[model samples]
Target: MNTDRFKENFLSFMNGCEFIYSEFKNGDFGDLQRVEVESFNKMGAVEFWSSGWVGIDLVDCVSGTQEISVLLSPEQRDLVDGELRRFADLMARR
Candidate 1:
C-alpha cells in the first residue's frame, strides 16, 4: 500500500464526510489524540490517531465496535478499507 498517498489523502478519503474535531484521549502514550469525522449519513464515524504510532478506527452508529461498512456505499467502503490497510501497514513499519 502506498501509505504516503494514504497519509496525504486520509482526511478526504470519504466523500461527504464532515470533519468533527480532534481531542486528546488518555492512553498508553498519555497524549493520544483522535481526529474524528462523521460519516456522510451521520450514522457512523472514522477516526485517525497518531500519538506515537498510527491507527484507525471505524465506529458503527450503534455497536461502536463495528466497522462503518453498514453505513457506507460499496465504493466508499473500499476507499475506507484501503486507507485502513495502509494505516495498518504504516503502523507496522513504525
Candidate 2:
C-alpha cells in the first residue's frame, strides 16, 4: 500500500473509466466513489471528489474516519480495489 503511488496514479486510475462521462453531460470523469476496506478488523477507505476542483484521498486504515470519494469507472474499479487492498494490508501489518 503506497500512499505516494496512489497519489501519483490517482488521475491515471480514472483514465480507463473515462467513458462513463457519456452518462451525463458533465460527466467528464469517473463517478464519485467512497470505497471502504477491511484492515485488521477495522474499516478503511479511499475517496475522490471535486466541487470547484478535483481531489482524492487514501484514508489510512488505522485511525481515520470515512471521508473520501473517487471518480470510479467500471474499468477502474479493479485498479482502485487493488490500491485499497494494498493500503489496507500495509496498515494491518502495523
Candidate whose lDDT is highest: 1
Native-referenced Cα lDDT, model 1: 0.43
lDDT assessment of candidate 2: 0.40
lDDT tens string, model 2, 1-94?
1234444644343322211111122334434333344444344445443222232344544566533444454445456555454544443443
lDDT of each structure?
Answer: 0.43, 0.40
Per-candidate TM vs. native?
Answer: 0.42, 0.28
Q: How many clashing pairs does model 2 include? A: 4
Best by TM-score: 1
Worst 10 residues of 2 by lDDT: 16-25
- Candidate 1 C-alpha lDDT tens digits along 1-94: 1233444656444555555545566765344444455553233333333333444555444444444232223335355556565433332321
